[model samples]
Target chain A: MTRITSMKPVGERAIRIGFEERISEETNRYIAALCKAIEEQVHPAVTEWVPAYASLTVYYKPETSGFDEMKSFLESCVKDVHDLEGEGGRVIGIPVLYGGEGGPDLSELASHHGMDEEEVIRLHSEGDYLVYMLGFNPGFPYLGGLSDKLHTPRRDNPRQNVPAGSVGIAGEQTGIYPLASPGGWQLIGRTPARLFDPEQPDAFLLRAGDRLRFRPVDEKEYDDLCSRVENGEQIVEVEEGEHAH
Target chain B: MSFTVEKPGLLTTVQDRGRQGYQQFGLSPAGAMDEYALQMANVLVGNERNEAVLEVTMMGPVLKAEKDMVIAFAGGNLQPAIDDEEVATWKSYHVRGGSKISFGRPVNGARLYLSVRGGIEIPEVMGSRSTYLKAGLGGFEGRELRKGDRIEVGEGAGSSEVHAGRRVASEHIPSYEKEITVRAVPGPQEDYFEKEALEQFFSEVFEVSHQSDRMGYRLQGEEPLKHKNGADILSDATAFGSVQVPGDGQPIILMADRQTTGGYTKIATVIGVDLWKVAQLPPGGKIRFKKTDVHEAQRLWQEQEDILVQVASYGRS
Candidate 1:
């Protein structure tokens, strides 16, 4: 289990819990556990908790508690949950349709890396990416562990509007746009899976620290998957893994 | 009871306090630029603080009331008139159906807030009526109010005793001039800049450039202090009133439309109490920095909150 070395208060009702080591699978597990612990320990006071790539920002109502009191309470809670790390997150598999209109800059990204489209897809699909954080858009996953061969820079001039579910690359990062919005990431593919649905109980399909596996799907499969999603089908499935604590 | 915009001015959007809790997902808190004024206007009309209000920029639109309603206006020094009658702002006024509300040339400030007895009835998106124009997420189909657009007003729950006689104190209204003073504290990333840069920031009066907007106000003056550690930091969470200095050496103060996270280094953050005054400043406005200790900043914040609480209590009476 991971141990928290220090916890610093960022604002009147927020604290930055720092770990001894850089963010890893274990650190991520501890973060989730810490969030759960904080939520349980400090009930109504904890208004919001945002998990970042390496840190968790806990926002609370200042009216309920002051900075010093909250910091001390968090310190005590951290000590209690010192060894309370949870099992690793479930690994999710997402099927993506690559190339053509589905991915306008696939060829450019492939050629930029001195690799063909097939090689790019193979390298990208082979890696088990880690969901570092969810940001840039609602339910948009910032996945790490991109293959070196597939690493590419963001477009010089991003499209004014990138459609929802569009998969794109920015430097070593890969993500799916959960909603249609202006983006600058280099588009390489798109997922028929609904990354976010406000109507659902859990709007976000994925959370930070979850393991992801991308499977290449053909154009026909892409259309079929989209239709399935429109019909209220949850395409992505998670498989339970052994506890890694 | 509502109104139709006969001629939309510079920019008009339905805005309330803002969408909170969604910032982690890259959603901006696209609320009223001058939250103080917005809240004041709402209070004058007996509406909740978060009720959707109209954020009119610079010159306001010519609006035709479709139904009889009580409306209140605040923020800046725009001359708002109803049917050629000069009406005092920051107070509730009764408008007959078909009455025309026109905004004359701007006398001072950049933005204005208009609140009705019952707030505008727009579909709440992600728990907010504030318009995020870039993402097209909330308020009037996620866009600015255009000419010929009809806005619906919810029924007022407060008394209809016609409190049109009441008006907000003029002393509370912020004055927008060529130069403005903003109080700020060193940011989390303030160490990134050189000590000399920090001194330069306080010594110089930065002019608000023309390239400023709701997202960020770009300043034109002395180049911001540069960082020797030039590696682009991973995008991290940002907040309203955060003063980020990009590579260009100019400071950009993030506002309502700022992204949840950004890569630029923030040297300082405008204290919450002064943010409303900052919002009222138009482009080309000169700004002088006043560094305050965190304790003083917090004290001022508490004082402002106390004032707001007092004002809010008055609405209940």
Candidate 2:
């Protein structure tokens, strides 16, 4: 059983439940399982659940529920839940065109580690990552499991506008800019796959507990994929079942 | 049937209670900053309390009624005038088709709620009509009101007659004060602060900085709230009234348009019942916080809900 380290009130209307402080696939799986259990439990007061690296925030209607009522419910849930459903989510393949104008920081990043650009691309593409959560921006996944070698500090002065689909790394994590936003991450590549479409009910391309892997593509493949996405095609590869190492 | 935007003011957008159940997807629940006012406006118009209403900010919009309709403008005395004759707030009026509703200098609060007989007929993106500007999601055309834009009215009871005379009782109307006291529940992360910092936070009189927006209110005080150490905390979910203290030691009250999560150490969350007071606070407004009793907060919420339940009766009696 995953121990719920602490359960505290965010306000009168919400409860935040914390797990192990470390970020790992094991803790993430337990959080995902707990989230699933809570959703299935279906308390009418439960309005939303936000699962992050090591915590899950439950937003409830204060008019219908109080912190004590919700806290006990979470406490009982933590005891009853045992299944760790992590590595088995849908694994999405994102195609990236690395090392160019699209990747403004590739050369700098490569030299920071005293490695060549090609090695950086190879290692980044080979990473089998987990989507710990999506929170910074709509559908922007907080991806984990980046090769430690590729770890780079965020830019001192962030770009005013990092175009959408720009894949970047900051410290221990790698993420993609789902929307055109001002970000501090070191940009290394760009993807053409659309991650967010507010018009669609299945708006987010990723969710907590999903597995993700990157594959390198040449300029021509990138162009072809970009056009297909613009034409409203789902171009990224998706596979069901446990992710392959 | 519709309202034409003759002149879009500083910021005007459609909002309901909020976009719920999508925060995990990184979607912020952008809604009316002043929930009490939004509910009051909707109630006065005989619309469901959560129906989409216009949130008019610092400046006010000039709207022309496309048809004879019952409309109510509540909260903030923004100097609203109809057909060049000023109209009192918190009361519904039967506006003629050609009548123009305009506003001049903001005399009181920062935001005003405008509700027509039928709610704004905007498609719900993620089960809400509230505008989340950063994402260009929800509301009219996924943006703020612009000049020459036409807005359609949604379906409702179709009785605009009785509501025309509806008015919120004077007692129920909240005064927009220059200095406001907001009650708060301690926090999800109050332990992250030093004991003196927590005490200092409640004692200080903070002024709302001009940099404040729908996302957050940056409050400046005589002394910064001291932290245990550096102010970085693990990024986590943020509530509407979360008072987050950053490395600068200043507290930023997370507002309606705040991001889903934040990385600063939050010391407290303003109670839901008192959120409207902060919402109405204009830049340069003064604010003080008090640690509230949980039971008292619940009682206050129930009190407000009780008044809301009798909203229609206020119009009759």
The digit string of per-residue lDDT tens for model 1 on B93-198 reads 8888899998987888888898888899988877889998877778887898888999999886233745565677666666667688888777656667878888
Q: In model 1, what is the error at residue B24, expressed in angstroms? A: 2.4
Best by lDDT: 2
lDDT of 1 by residue, A1-245 (tens): 56665554432334555565354766676777777678677556666666665566666655456556777777776776655434567799999998889789998988988889998888888888888667666677767788776778788897998998888888888888888878888888999988777556666788776799989999888899889998988888787656632
lDDT of 2 at A73: 85
Model 2 stretches with alpha carbons more than 4 Å out: A85-87, A242-245, B156-159, B312-317
- Return the TM-score for candidate 2, rounded to 2 decimals: 0.96
Candidate 1 docking classification: acceptable
**Model 1 misplacement above 4 A:** A1-23, A43-46, A181-184, A199-201, A231-233, A238-245, B157-159
DockQ per candidate: 0.36, 0.69
lDDT of 2 at A144: 87
Q: Quote the positional error of residue B125 for candidate 1 in Å.
A: 2.3
